[model samples]
Target: MENHALKSWPDVAPKLVAVAAGRAPADTVLKGGAWVNVHTREVLENHDIAIAEGRFAYCGPDASHCIGPDTQVIDCAGQYMIPGLCDAHMHIESGMLTPAEFARAVAPHGTTSMFTDPHEIANVMGLEGVRLMHDEALLQPINIFTQMPSCAPSAPGLETTGFEITPDDVAEAMTWPGIIGLGEMMNFPGVVNADPKMLAEIAATQRAGKAVGGHYASPDLGPAFHAYAAGGPADDHEGTCEADAIARTRQGMRHMMRLGSAWYDVETQITAVTEKGLDPRNFILCTDDCHSGTLVNDGHMNRVVRHAIECGCDPLIALQMATINTATHFGLERELGSISPGRRADVILTSDLGTLPIHRVIARGVTVAIEGEMKVDCPHLDWPAHARDTVHMGRALSGADFEIAAPAGANHVTANVIGVVENQAPTKALKAELKVQDGLVPGDPEQDVCQIALVERHQATGGVVNAFVSGFGYTGQMAMASTVAHDSHHMIVVGTSHADMALAANRLQEVGGGVTIWKDGKELALVELPIAGLMSDAPATEVAAKADKMVQAMEACGCTLNNAYMQHSLLALVVIPELRISDLGLVDVRTFELTPLFDEGQDQ
Candidate 1:
């Protein structure tokens, strides 16, 4: 296989010197542009950049001396030449596309670099799966640095996974060429409490001279948060409010404010820089999870930068948050994140500063995109057959499996419900009074209460753990089932009708794995993510088309939440607080314990 890793700066330094000294001709020269200097936070006009060996050789007022007869010169026409945007933290699988396809989709939006955590795949296929993601990431035209997944079963004892990422796995991944750091250490409690395994994994990454990502999902800024900070996580992206951002940066961690498809955190958190006057250098921008439809219709990191600006951030500061700040957080500032000499020649030409329009994009000295269209080919991996056949339901399910039997002739009960908050990651733990129907507790659509079941797909045990959920506004006999459940990657079915839920679950099992929606006992939409049941190998536009139909189907079922599919996928994420359902049982995340579904003592 061809190694797509870029040549080191030292390996090509002599050539760079020769080109800068006019001893050799440059391969390409971008002339007559306004440089957005991130290092000094200034826009200098009439700047020209010379490239050699896919690295910047000269960036000054004039590079005419480096230009030879054969050099390819492109006039920038006074466009704002900014460093190519970078996503500090993201997941390729969240796009429902493989690394190659995700890169192809975002490259056109001027995102030349991404630091992705492949933890989703690791939960399903283990180290081999992570290697597949890392190898494919190295083949892309843009930079896709892999973070070794630190938490497979994100909350160790709270949930079960197909595979567990051990300390040895973390050490082994550090040897890979594409690995940048350890992925977000979702096990915050483990770190704070000094669990040997979690500490060992962090130690291995630190010993290897890589960044250790953080995921302190709790809202508490008490001793626990401080202990987690003291445990050696260098950066965190789970901050949702200004206080969270302030606390993180105060503890010397980069605060990565994210704006993904469902996560709207930048607006509330960016105020730490915009209003409170915190140093902008300590704040970074990222998209923790954006699906294919968002990538195709909206933008990638470009969208984040624009959103930050819209949230009252200074244009130059927002650009820095997406570029130099991110690169610096990952210890990659010298290799990328700027248009400086010795850095990779990743630059974006845009006409505006605030409402940025991607006029052209250049990665590794190659023009990869123009006018919101891809200009270069992103290579794909030959996925094995085992990856496509991961859904193991043991046997076909029925309405009986989904039935929530009343506790020995009890007519009424106060049920613990998982409440979905719109455009947020956290859920509210709610209590609702539900009545029994024919010796079984039934979901009431009028009160917006619905049945949620976690069907264990990993072990094929055919185990179904039932609970209740609200805030989807779903009505009628509809059910939605997804194999892309977070952390555990089990099958999560939410519906008002047991039969439709059964139909949805069976449909996903039959198609290997993916998301399926059924209403009135008929299939409404299906976005088949056959690869490990997390992502598809299809093109972004194609997958996005199906995702659009899926969204329409959700709307038709009366779901009013923004990006309800993302909400559905995260119903099983035990790391986040309040309540969630897992293969084990209904999780009370605030206390990190399994709680019963019905509380018969409480009244409505």
Candidate 2:
């Protein structure tokens, strides 16, 4: 079915005029409700909201004149009316679902707007994939704006990708109906260094007067960070601390504190406004990378707002951050931020503001979700079959393929290990002494060190780089493999046993790249993400249930890191600090240099 439900006020205004003048029918009038004014942080009681032509025509203490012979009126019983929640920065692909499925998952959560970046898909399927996401997003029941993917490879020479995004692509996407801005500028180093390509993309977004999203993952508050700020990114969601939030706001960039499925960064950073008392207007709430499990089971933007309230923020202030602050940041304040005139009539009804439970959701003056269930039809996109068969390893891999032969005559060695930082995307550059057994480096469960490998799948290049990682609390013979590796879409397999690791990695390749878990050489769970190796066409419920099993498998393997799968995916990500693995070799993010897996006479 086609989705043509604009619910614009133009069609409803004339009827409201008649109701005001006693001539025609009024659609619906909500009376005796408390207007939770986010702009003033006050609640005005006993107000009546007049609806006509699918818009809120008049809102006051009394709209008796708006009542017509055929008018339908409902007494709200003094329920508080709040604006619909808005997500400032996110990637639908991060939900591991297509735009249609992502919408289906979040629509019930009173989330009406989303600024999504499709770079995850672009890295694997290129421009066509990005356009597919953009088009499908616009067809949803609510506003789903697209930020043209800015960085496909993420780091130009650091890692390889199935496809690359060019400057020309950025310029043309700005003309698309759903295009809102450029995706996160992950090339922060390049921007600071005046890279011509990065500059060109920024210029195109600037020329269109649209927002330029940011991803300055570095904690450096020095000249390098300053130079990146000067490069035209208007907002950032990578900040993890109060200082990171303050630094961005001080430099005229919106500080987006996000609370996603795993990245619980809001509490640490929201202190900039809640305690340090920076202006809350410059802070925005978002879900940087929400998985479908979180979206379907928990709320999206609404969850972020509730998290902010729990983080010592005033409920009203948090709502403003989630709504008006987000709208103003994207230059859409006048259109969607509040209940002001000419704005889209997207509002929510709840009994309390602090524990914001959405009893009803009205978007564009149409009841979309009632009691946390979608009441309207959310259209789906006709996804092509090619998106379901993307995994292409030239051939099946064996246990021998995963074996990392020790250097000639090397028995013991110290190796560079990628340290997993719980609840954060960044890794640590660590040196660990490892034991070499039978000419092969092995992990020490006592040391919490495990083997990490990146198998290059972009060009079918038979390249695999092996490294080490800590902080998983892993204590068994198990492995996990996923194609959801961030930025660079390679397959990263991590395990204590090379046999299980090889089995898990080969399982994904056997069924097309997705996520897989192996325990003592047995397949435990799998999610086939064939769409650019990042998303599945399965329903959110189905995917979340499967992902739950994967999470359970991780737990069964004695892994105890928070959201260990998310930490695993960053194994091949070269942007974040301190150590990472690519198809080439282990990288020291701090020094950007290649490091060996072992040092002489040290078990690493």
Candidate 3:
């Protein structure tokens, strides 16, 4: 019923002619080129390729016999013809765009393939959300592979999701044409501990002969990591260092190095192949979460490829990581990934191997991107009604709602504070002494302490978790709030002033849902993400412009980090690290325990 390229596909006359004459179809022959062959791990000089029906008919020393008088051929002028790049692991929702728009944004970056996990949307909308994403992805011109989201709440019992994804969901999704594998098993602890739900999902993927993606965020690599590997996640992209890469690959897991808007992971981890001299085949490149800002400005897999080369990685090996390694990981090797015969004719023409200056991109034998702009229209999906109105802030909030009340008359008290590092995903669990004023836990400006609130938007149950945070560099009246909190999908609002916090939070709900910047009792900017209170349907450029404005607003508010909003959004994601905030309360992420908002001497 389905044309799984693994079996058979209808051949257009080109392949037959190539097979008969011992030459590939030159429907569009790229001549006078150097083929960067991932299979041979070498760049073959003076090569030619023939394309047919959006598939590579052949790539070798010659394609002359397949070229007819009607065949169109382009002279590469002796440039490097490389396979289109692939993002081994990523989240389409993380870009804050639908799959269709996300495709349009990255297609020009020579990223012909992507292995995406929609866990963010899954947390809010569950199986239906993932299904929508999967169905839409199949319509894209490029290879957009969807991974069945493994963790909906991410941590069962620790947090609650609007909808739950069961093993039945996983088993059913496996039959979909676009599903490549299971999404990152974020519940590594559950898997390692033999939790039935986690095991069931992994089992379904394995049973279906699909890969199980990994996300062991912890740096341990002790019994926990060993037990997790035993649980069967085939590849991991959470590694942030060379040693992390070494450990994952040594345990028979593909180490996926990522580079994104906020995450600078590739340069630090690629040394597994470059310096440690590990087998390059085990490495792959990814953009775990490329925000609209990154896709519009920085480039997608192209950025990773360029960064890998900067890290002293061999250009050929880097291409393999971005192409074949990714395809092979998701059981798509025979269908896509390379410039070999029978594969999707996804290729990029670049003048310099090291620089990776993408001059042209070809997908399925069709020229899609010439220079930097898209040359064709990427189709769109008719998103459902529920997907557009997911923000449900039960009631409006005032300054008092965000205030932290202290025990009767305690003067100075110790409290659990979230300490933000400069540009990392993890947070610091900090215990600090703070002063109390009028039966309230007052923030210490000297300690960079500011208020953080988690507004429960899922059920409109009127729940709010108030806490303290550092590293926003707030010096004046300002606040930032968004419903884009990861994993739990709550509204994370941070501010130096309670008045600004209340205003920012209420404004987001008024706009359905989105991030808002407020300073000096005035609203600075807004990016209306009507969908799930998390993403906007606006074009990538439109989203990027608003995001840039947000960055400027943060700068205006004296908050300084590479991408402070990205850092801000991660503050409530309890699964990743040391500290976080949830609708339940302040979370000690390492222990996954409920920490008191203020010191023991203070009130809850």
Clashes of each: 0, 9, 3
lDDT of candidates 1 onward, in order: 0.94, 0.83, 0.85
Tell me the TM-score of each prediction against the true structure.
Answer: 0.99, 0.95, 0.96
State the displacement of the C-alpha of residue 263, model 1, in Å, after optimal TM-score superposition.
0.4
Pairs that collide in candidate 1 are none
Candidate 1 vs 3: which has more TM-score = 1
Q: Write the per-residue lDDT of candidate 2 for residues 1-604, one digit (tens) a residue.
A: 1224664456555655665564655567777889877777778898877766556667677878778777778777759888888999998888888887888788778888899998888988889888889888878878888999999788877777888999999999998878899999998888999999999999999999999999998999999889999999999999888899999999999999888887999999988987899999999999988887788788888888998998899998999998888888898876687765556777888888888888988877788888878887766778788776666666667777777777777777777788999999888888877666899878788889888888877777677777788988776788899999887878898888888887887788877778998887798889878778888778889999988888888889898777777787777878788888887787777766666776655433
Q: Lowest-scoring 10 consecutive residues by lDDT in candidate 1?
A: 1-10
Which pairs, if any, clash in model 2?
12-52, 12-53, 413-602, 414-599, 433-603, 433-604, 434-603, 434-604, 435-603
Which residue pairs does candidate 3 place in steric collision?
54-364, 414-599, 415-599
C-alpha root-mean-square deviation, each candidate: 1.1, 2.2, 2.1
Cα-based lDDT at residue 32, candidate 2 = 84
Our model 3 lands, by Cα RMSD against the true structure, at 2.1
